[model samples]
Target: MIRLSRIPHQLLTWGIPMGPLMLLRTRGRHSGLLRTVPIATLRHDGHHWLVSPFGDTHWVRNLRADARAELGRGHRFRPVRLVEVDDDRKLEILHAYRGAFGLVPFVRDAFDADAGAEPHVFAREAHRHPAFLIQPAG
Candidate 1:
């Protein structure tokens, strides 16, 4: 259902804004097939980020096995290296994600921390939601 909803946004031209959503393409660990899903990104502290509001999901597992993935916004897809952010550095990203997207019910419900919660609140909540910093792949 989520994938279906994102198809239109995936087709839009790169110049147009599509909010924070992007199509994440990962190679399946078991099947070795390419899997795609729409996910929200956090652009914080001069870096692009990927946060799994739902915790460690399938895509997260796949990405763990293969850091090589593609992030597609509209018609433009770029190869990216997804480095799982360490807990120490993840607090700010989590806070930023909450501040930016916490209004959405799903995102809000995913964490125990409130939108205006302090950094430590997010630090405790960070384990449930894995975050990755997106870097341009060589």
Candidate 2:
């Protein structure tokens, strides 16, 4: 599974456009070490955003502990602050994300929304997938 996940990361590292994917670097809340993972990304409401497709994973917990993180593309990484999106706004972003990448099997499986689910359908599953807005960090 880890090997398979690295494929896209490798592609991204090679400067291939993998469609809304990026390398997220975060400080381990407990270990106090840097951890990086490749995850999907989105642009909503004129802001950069990301979602935890698997729900409350390690990275999410780390971010909750410390909002400071890095958003990276290939070899380039920059400082960024992550803000947890509110439920109301998260629903909209989730809907938009589904609309944009719904055809991808994993993305489709992440939500309760079906192939043609309406925006409200996403609202039902919004809490399960945490969404964060990326901001420039000082």
Best by lDDT: 1
Clash totals, every prediction: 0, 0
Q: Considering summed lDDT, which 10 consecutive residues are worst modelled in model 1?
A: 8-17
Total clashes in model 2, counting residue pairs 3 or more apart in sequence or in different chains: 0
For residues 1-138, what per-residue lDDT tens digits would candidate 2 score against the true structure?
468678887787776777788888999999999988888888877877888778999999999999999977767888999999875688788888887778877777777887477667777777788989999997
Please provide TM-scores, in order, for all candidate models, with all chains considered together. 0.87, 0.89
Find the 10 residues in a row with the least total lDDT in model 2.
Answer: 115-124
lDDT of 2 at 46: 89
Segments of candidate 2 deviating more than 4 angstroms: none
